[model samples]
Target: MSIISSTSHATSNTATLSQRLTAAIGASILGACLVYFAGFSHIEAVHNAAHDTRHSAAFPCH
Candidate 1:
């Protein structure tokens, strides 16, 4: 009986871990899509923004 109960508990834990992993991966894909669209939609704007940011951070762009 004790072994059965422990096995059930482990199965539940595995299910929970899998669900969390799926959610995390979905969120990451969604975020990547958003960034890709935003950056690619206006290439010039994104490049200018990044250039300004680098200057602000004192990074030598030249």
Candidate 2:
């Protein structure tokens, strides 16, 4: 009985870890899409803002 309980507890922890990892990956993809779109936006203000950010981060946008 104790072994069974411990096994279930480990599974629960694995599920929680999987959920957190999925969320992190999803958020990273969304953020990358947002940045890519904003960086290339036709709107000058948005494009410049992203460009400035790249410069600030020393990302070598040029």
lDDT of 1 by residue, 1-62 (tens): 35554444444435588899999999999999866665456678876776687789998978
lDDT of 1 at 32: 95
Question: Model 2, stretches more than 4 Å misplaced?
Answer: 1-15
Tens-digit lDDT track of model 2 for 1-62: 35554444444434588899999999999999998899779999999998998899999977
Clashing pairs in 1: none
Q: What clash pairs does model 2 have?
A: none
Query: What lDDT does model 2 reach?
Result: 0.86
Top lDDT prediction, candidate number: 2
